[model samples]
Target chain A: AQSVTQLDSQVPVFEEAPVELRCNYSSSVSVYLFWYVQYPNQGLQLLLKYLSGSTLVESINGFEAEFNKSQTSFHLRKPSVHISDTAEYFCAVTRGGADGLTFGKGTHLIIQP
Target chain B: NAGVTQTPKFRILKIGQSMTLQCTQDMNHNYMYWYRQDPGMGLKLIYYSVGAGITDKGEVPNGYNVSRSTTEDFPLRLELAAPSQTSVYFCASSYLESTGELFFGEGSRLTVL
Candidate 1:
């Protein structure tokens, strides 16, 4: 069985400040990692994914997540956040088959002006 | 493209009531999935289908039933609604089972009273 853990349930950061949302996973086999974002009253959208290429993956919206196999972690990071960046972020993992993604509890990123 | 569309954006059900949530995808993807999102919790997979008529249970499938009669349609049925089932449900589709990105619908909010 695979499971994901997000250390922070809520992260409050000032606008224009850097932020990191921590995520860790436990899986017996190799896995693909992903970060998803959900805004208020909306479905989740993929932020970035690490399939089999480089350990670091970036999203078009300036968010990036690094897959660290040794640490069993994939943490999402943003150099600077904006008011529009306020949303809930989730970390997910899936093995190399037809299995569905296992998601963490999620971290609410609240940007303060 | 509409990508994925879920009907009844918002619904309210009473105890012991039954209803079905309809989902369709315009992209003609072979893989479709159903997930539920609870407050402070990330999405949990309810059921998934590989193709028309090939459906399987996912992480959370206790109170739900699903049918995939066509490549584009996958509807989830709730036998008896309960307060625990009150959450936002999302329908998603992907081209591949493992590595492809998932396109999700706006989501259907269900409130059971």
Candidate 2:
């Protein structure tokens, strides 16, 4: 079985400030990691993913997550965040097979200007 | 594209009542999943279907049942409602199980009293 843990329950940052949301996972087999973002009243959307290859995967919206195998972490980071980036972020992991992902409790990003 | 569609955006049910949440995807995805989101919990996988006629349990599948009789439809059934069952349900589909992005529905909010 796979499990995900998000260390922060809520993070408040000023607009245009950098932020990092920590995520760690535990799995017996190889895993695929993903970051999903959910806006106020919308469903979750994929922000980025790490399957294989470069440990650093980036989303088009300037969000990036680095997969650290030794640390079992896939922390999401953004150099500069906007007010619109306020949302709930989730970290998920799967064993790279026909299985559903295990998700973290989520980190609520609150941007203040 | 309509993408993944989930019916009854909001529903209220009393304890011991039974109801079915309908889900459908028009993207011809072979993998479909049902997840529930609580207040602080990100999301928990309740059930998943690899394809038509093939369904499996996910991380949290105790109080829910699911059926996938066709390639486009996967309905989640709650035999008897409980207060714990009150949550936002999301239906998602993907072309690949672990390596692809998951397209999600708007979500179905269910309240049980």
Q: State which candidate has the highest DockQ.
A: 2
Model 1 spans > 4 angstroms off:
B97-100
Best by lDDT: 2
Model 1 chain B — which ten-residue stretch has the worst lDDT?
B94-103
User: What value does the lDDT take at residue A65 in candidate 1?
Assistant: 89
Candidate 2 yields a Cα-based lDDT of 0.93
lDDT, candidate 2, at A76: 97
> What would the TM-score be for candidate 1 when compared with the true structure?
0.97
lDDT of 2 at A47: 92
Q: What TM-score goes with each of the models? A: 0.97, 0.97
Residue B62's lDDT within candidate 1 is 95
Over A1-113, each residue of candidate 1 has an lDDT whose tens digit, in order, gives: 88999999999999999999999999998888999888988888889999987898899989998999899999999999999999999998888455768889999999999
* Model 1 lDDT tens row, B6-93: 9999999999999999999999888999999988778899999999989999989999999999999999999989999999999998
Cα lDDT for residue A63, candidate 1: 92
